[model samples]
Target: MSGPGPARPRLLGCDFSSTPSRRKPIVLAWGRCEGNTVMLEALERFPTLSAWTGRLAQVPAWIGGFDFPFGLPREFVIAQGWPLDWAGCMATYTALGRAELRERFVAFCAARPVGGKFAHRAADRPAGSSPSMKWVNPPVAWMMHAGVPGLLAAGAWLPGQGGVVGAPRVALEAYPGLVARDLLGARSYKSDERAKQTPQRQAARVELLHRLGAGEGRLGLRLQAPDALGQVFVDDASGDALDAALCLMLAAWGEARAESEGPGFGLPARMDPLEGWIVGA
Candidate 1:
């Protein structure tokens, strides 16, 4: 009698690259969530950050999970004497060149003791994510710099951190590794290096896909991908496509929560707006 209810909004998951190029583009998984199933529609590649930003702006409505830090640790911000508010802090942060940002972060770390060099967001421990300020070994600091500005400029709502009120397009910070580790548990499922793409890793990918399809995680959502698309997810040695797919699942999970939980998108109510919480953390 309800006649299937309203259609779900389009969902997206982004596997971002700080410096996107043709060889290592930003990978996006476009999909929709229906009941407990997250259906994959396509995988898009953006050869440059500008192209990616343009695509984000063009989409009329979407809930996107982006695999990048949207904010830095509050401790790091305070120690560096940066502004305490999200907008001011981000403005100061984005004004600096990558070289300068790295220099400041390095200096801040050098003042601290070994094993406690990097300051972490509260979300980091629960999400098992690297500190947002780390300049290398992933360079997520660069990711925040390159990625968050575009989200802000595109008028995508960032939940707790400031954004256009009631904006149709929503962006949430997401880390696919959290979902992967939940199912795989310390198993490495993907690698960018050719030599590291062993049969073992490939097997891990197969297992992850299977688990996701079966709705085996806390999110309680199954992944439905076309047979050919599923093969593409597994065959890409880099794991970019697969990671994007993981983010898509997280976005769907958040969207499901939004219907009941309001604008927090499943994030904690008391979360510090200065350091954004990862969705589902």
Candidate 2:
């Protein structure tokens, strides 16, 4: 309920999109420790950056993992003549409307050949994401635009990205799938379809929990259909919800680390407000 502690910081892992207008806003699943067990709360859906952030400010956490770029590739920001610093870069990007930003980003990619178009941050090279602000694959550039400024506005640590100094809110970039893959391999855990959230994925999740050392039994985490918001589906699967659920898992991990490791757990290496990082346990 308070700061990140051995009591388990509240975590929210997010799988963001370049645009959330048509999609299920921003999928959010929150996690915290219930006594000695790590469990998830009911999924909360937010319609915009404002709503998402308002919830975060109210919910005290050591840090939460957001699946978005921490910074834009220095090359891209430089090429575009945008601000060089994290805070400044966010200002420049967020000033533009979605249409304007998209057109400009697309133009940047159009000028370059197939593989030559987008810029890649140093972290993207290791993370295996394209540098360009393309909409598909990993639309990190767009994610940066939508996700970063919100955190900055909330006065969160952003880590590699300089945050509003002395803000109590702290957030680390995180990708739950990365950690899930480590624990569950390529096994698909959640589905967008009412039918696909089957025994198989449930079993997979149960097994995944065990791998995370939660062997006693089911805790607070359980995958269920979102009651209010329209569900998001990919290839006939409810991946959006699952992805949001995964974000919650990542938050739990970040909470654990920040409590044990201090502020270092929330800071980043390169400090990109545009290109985000993924925190691991």
Candidate 3:
């Protein structure tokens, strides 16, 4: 019998925590695709940013979907008189201390009227993502402040940011809630609060997994999970595991598109470089 050929390239999706610790870690859901099927191979947990960044720097030849904004809204960037170019903006952004960043953002939000305090990126409209500058009630702004620079330092090529030539790793912005909503129709799946981890959400998780395995979504990609791995997804009350799986599927979808449609990982032609697009939205 012929020996197995080289292993298929893998794809990854990460559910990140801005403040990670032993109790709450950055979770990576990784897998490979075979035709229309995505096999969720493993879950990696990094309890600190250093550990996570090390993985990002060393890992090669994979497409990853991460749950953090790749860029802030162009309008917001412009208003702050920051660099118009993605690269410059990133450089300027990553240089600031978190306290200064937070103070600036808070002041910006406070000056605006109610119901219009936060500026939105173009991708936010379709993806239904929160404004990347919002510091409260999800605090995705901090996530971006903490996450994107690490990705760049790791030498991961961002599609909208002139894409590093010949770089093996491609990073795309992802939001698991977007995919979850597409499948389960606004049913809540995971919650950080112990009080909110209801049975309803648990059932929703199982149902979503079953639907994904059956290839019942926009990408038409099936999920393959053995019983042991499947239980791992269900048992996590915080939903980090489930979110990572959803992101992994999105990465697989983008990979399939890259093969058929010639790179860009299926992102739109007119996407804003200053405000990166979410992979599937």
Better of 1 and 3 by lDDT: 1
lDDT digits (tens) for residues 184-279 of candidate 2: 767987764687777677777656554544433222333332333213322224456556655665565555555667666634544455555556
Q: TM-score per candidate, in order?
A: 0.97, 0.71, 0.95
Computed on alpha carbons, the lDDT of every model, listed in order, comes to 0.93, 0.62, 0.86
RMSD of 1: 1.9
RMSD of each: 1.9, 6.0, 2.2
On lDDT, the leading prediction is: 1
lDDT of 3 by residue, 1-281 (tens): 99997555679999998889888999998888999999988999999998998998877678899998988888778878999999889889878887898888878888889999888988888888889888777889888888887787788888867457547788889989888888898799888999998999899999999999899978789999778879988888899988988889889988888889987888998898888899889
Taking the tens digit of each residue's C-alpha lDDT, what string does model 1 give over 7-83?
Answer: 55689999999999999999999999889999999999999999999999998889999999989999999988999
Model 3 alpha-carbon miss at residue 129, Å: 1.1
Task: Answer with 2 or 3, whichever has the higher lDDT.
Answer: 3
The positional error of residue 165 in candidate 2, measured at the CA in angstroms, is 2.9
Candidate 2's TM-score reads 0.71
Query: Local error of candidate 3 at 54, Å?
Result: 1.0
Q: Which runs in model 1 stand beyond 4 Å of their true positions?
A: 1-7
TM-score of 1: 0.97
